[model samples]
Target: MILSQKLFVATLTAMFTFFILPLFFVEENANDYFIGFVVSSVTIPFIFTFGLLTSMLIGNFCHKYHLKKIISFLLHIVSGVICLMIFAVYIFITGGSPEGYIQTGLMIALLCITVFFYIDIVMKKKSK
Candidate 1:
């Protein structure tokens, strides 16, 4: 996943440098490049970084509180809910679709919950 994440980031950086940056120098050719592609591609890094950082934060929170599995799961839900709050803010200010933000947030929360539960099970088996 780390390798894949790095590749994704590098690709986005290269694309921005090569394709998007050139648009600034040549204003007339701006129509040659697709705005939607550039906008959407830029979001890839933000979602990926947010997911990773939020997952780490949740893990640390669980450890610090000595939370049970159920409580940890609930915490994930709470964090996911916070994403909706962000969605609402975007709607009010930006007037763009918020589905992607909501989906990314929920998916990352689910992924983190799944990993935590899987690791918990493995640790329990080792104890036995």
Candidate 2:
């Protein structure tokens, strides 16, 4: 359990870096890059934390209401997939590269860990 918690944190930190690194380093224009950096800094925390917090709350609500974990997880995953697909299309339309989606996946994996950890800290749940 301790190992999993440590590992979860480690993975999340890595994923978060993956998501933010390109925005910090890879813009064609310096001004645009700075804007991206500022945007990333301001938005990432709110987005990651709030999304995790709400999802964890929802998961707890489901658990309390006797929904099976598998079902709840599947439903959440399906919704995530649909959202990711939409994001991918938008990125494509906007001329973002495939690597951006890969990075987005890292961001998502980070958020999943953040959600788990939020529940862990708030509800004292143990990682499996």
Count the clashes in each prediction: 0, 0
Full-model lDDT for every candidate: 0.55, 0.56
lDDT of 1 at 122: 54
- Tell me how many residue pairs clash in candidate 1: 0
lDDT for each residue of candidate 1 in 75-94, tens digit (9 for 90 to 100) = 65676566556655766588
TM-score per prediction, in order, is 0.44, 0.41
Clashes of 2: 0
* Tens-digit lDDT string for candidate 2 (1-128): 43454445544654755665565345488897777678558656654555444455556677789987656656556544554565567667889875666565646644554554444454334423
Residue pairs in clash, model 2: none
Q: What's the residue-level lDDT of 14 in candidate 1? A: 45
**Candidate 1 to truth, TM:** 0.44
* Model 2 misplacement above 4 A: 1-27, 68-128
Model 1 score (lDDT): 0.55
